[model samples]
Target: MGVSGCGKSTVGEELAKQLGVPFAEGDKLHPASNVKKMAAGTPLNDDDRWPWLDLVGADLRKGYEADGIVISCSALKKIYRERLRESCGGPLAFVYLEGSVDLLTERMGARTGHFMPLSLLQNQLATMEVPTGEPGVVTVNIDASPEEIVANALKGLASL
Candidate 1:
C-alpha cells in the first residue's frame, strides 16, 4: 500500500503467485462513481473510500477462508487500514510498496487505462500515513526490479 503508481498490483500478483495463493486487485472493487471521480482526476474523500475498503476487506476475508490471498489496495490512511482490519476480523499483512515521488510520477505518467490520474498523485501522497511501526505492515523499497521487490516482500512477510 503506497501511492497510486507504487506497483501494488504488479507486486501483489507476483507475491500471490510466489505464495501459491489467490490474488485480488482492490481497484476492481471500487464503485463506479468512485472510479468515475478518479478517472476525472478528482481526489476521493473519506466517504468515497470507506465502502470500497469494506468490499476489499470482504474479498480478502472470503479468500482467506480457503487460503492465503494477496490484494493490491492503496490503504493510504491509518483509519482506512483499520477499517479493513476490522472488516476482516483482524489485521492482514500489508506490503507497503515504497518509492520516491519522482519515480511514482514517472510511473503514473507512463501508465494507461487506469482510473487514477497523475494529477492526483500529490493528493494520494499527502493522504498516505506511511504505516511506520504499524503492526503487520512490511515496507519494501520499490526502487528495484519487480522480482527483487517481490523477494523482499516475501522475506519481510516471513519475518512477521
Candidate 2:
C-alpha cells in the first residue's frame, strides 16, 4: 500500500507476476463518481472511499479463495488498512511503498491518463500512516525501478 503516484500499480503488477498470483489493480474498482471527483482534482474523503475499498476487498477475498493475490491500493491510513483487512476476512500482509513528496509530484506530473491529480498528493501523504513496526508489513523505498522494488518486496515478503 502507498500514496498515489508512488508506483503502486506498476510495482504491484511486477510483484504479482513474479509471485504467480492474481494481480488486481485497486483503481479499477472505484465508482464512477469517485473517478469523476478525482479527475476534477478533488481528494476523496473516507466517505468517498469506503465503498470503493469494500469492492476491492471483495476481489481480494474472492481471489484468496483460489490462490494468493496481489493488489495495488492506496491503503493510506491505519483505518484504511483495517478496512481492507476486514474486507479480506482477516489479516493481510502488505508491502508499503514510500517516497518523498517531491518524487511523487514529479511522477504524477509525468503520468498521463490517470484520474488522480498531483494536487491531492499532499493530502494523501498527510493521511498516510507509516508501517512502523507493524506486523505482516514490509516497507519499501520508492526510488528504485519497478523491477527492483518488486524484487526487494519479494525478498522481504519471503522473510515474513
Candidate 3:
C-alpha cells in the first residue's frame, strides 16, 4: 500500500480479479471520525489509525479463510503493518505502490469525490515508512500504465 492517488484501489481491484479473489476497499472500513478528520484536511495520528488497521486486518483474515482477498490500505508505518499482520494472524502480502511526489500530487489533484484532500498528500508522504526490505512486500513503481503496474505486481507476488 502507498499514499493516496498511488492507485492502490485500482491496482488491488485488478489484481484480485486476475487472481479470482475477493476485493475489499479498505477506505470503506474507516471509522466515521477518521473519515471526517481526513475530509477536514487533518492528518491522522497513530491513535486514529490503530482501530482502523484492526478492521482492515479482520477483513483480511476473513477473506483469507475464504481463499484469498485483496485490499487497498494506506499502511504507512512499520508498526502499522505489524499490527495488521498480528490482527490477521495469517500470511499477508503488501503491494507497495511507490511513485514520485510530483506524480502522486498530480494524480491526487486530478481525482475528485475522494475524502482525502490533495493537501494531505504531503503529510502522507512524510508519514510513510516505505516498505523497502520488508518481508512479504512487493514494491511496484507507479510511473507505468495501470496494466503494466498490475502485471509487475502479479509477477512480484508470484515470486513471493
| Best-fitting candidate, scored by lDDT | 3
Model 3 misses residue 21 by how many Å? 0.4
Tell me each candidate's RMSD, in Å, in order: 0.9, 1.1, 0.6
Work out the TM-score per prediction. 0.97, 0.95, 0.98
Clashes of 1: 0
Q: Candidate 2 or 3, higher TM-score? A: 3
lDDT of 3 by residue, 61-106 (tens): 8988889999999999999999888877689999999999999999
* Residue-by-residue lDDT tens digits, candidate 1, 61-158: 88777667888999999999988887776458989999999999999999998889899999999999999998999999999999999999999999
Instruction: Show model 1 residue runs off by greater than 4 Å.
Output: none
In candidate 3, the residue pairs with backbone N, CA or C atoms under 3 Å apart (3 or more residues apart, or in different chains) clash, namely none
Which pairs clash in the backbone of model 2? none
Question: Which parts of model 2 are misplaced by more than 4 Å?
Answer: none
Residue 68 of model 3, lDDT score:
92
User: How many Å off is the CA of 112 in candidate 1?
Assistant: 1.3
